[model samples]
Target: MFHTDCPAREVVDHVTSRWGVWVLISLRSNDLRFYELRESIRGISEKMLAQTLRALVQDGLVWRQVEPTTPPQVTYGLTEFGREVGESLAELFDRITQRLSPRDAG
Candidate 1:
């Protein structure tokens, strides 16, 4: 459905989905482990977070690295392309949040 014709719409949908926006903005600063991301993003269910990460990975916007270890450490970070997109999303997130604040609304 997304890839039918408008590639821009597909990218916008991926970047702006509820959890997708938060995920991209969260990863803008540093690489984070699965639990770290879960903790950082309040109110996100485990299933939803997993699904969001999977979609971002499929979109080439996030990188999933699995290290060799006893339990196997997994971390996520943005790709170069993702970083560029993430920065834009971050700015948008900030602007929206600020504009919607009580003081700003008043």
Candidate 2:
């Protein structure tokens, strides 16, 4: 029988990607529209945001919802799986921050 490789590698790559992590962390706050995410994540180029969102969506970490109303409203939010991933990353960030306080930064 044919079997596939572990999906962890891909998931890690997607979630840990430079923009991917920020996007996930930002979305952790609440569902955000495309422009809202762009604005919230300052200095993130439009191209990078688009690409990151696409990759996250492919990894099933981000849920993109589109409404057919005029002007077409699209919002992005963390899926249940993504929330778990985001929480883990958030904890890692907190630990790293605590480890690297002003004393360590100096």
TM-score of each: 0.84, 0.83
**Model 1: per-residue Cα lDDT at residue 44:** 98
Compose the digit string of candidate 2's lDDT tens values, residues 1-106.
1234667777787888888888988998899999999999889999999999998998889999999999999999999999999988888877887889788754
| Per-candidate RMSD, Å | 2.9, 3.5
Task: Score candidate 1 by lDDT.
Answer: 0.90
**Candidate 2, 35: how far from true, in Å?**
1.2
Q: Candidate 1: where is the Cα deviation over 4 Å? A: 1-3, 102-106
Local error of candidate 1 at residue 2 (angstroms): 8.8
Per-model CA lDDT versus the true structure:
0.90, 0.89
- Give candidate 2's TM-score: 0.83
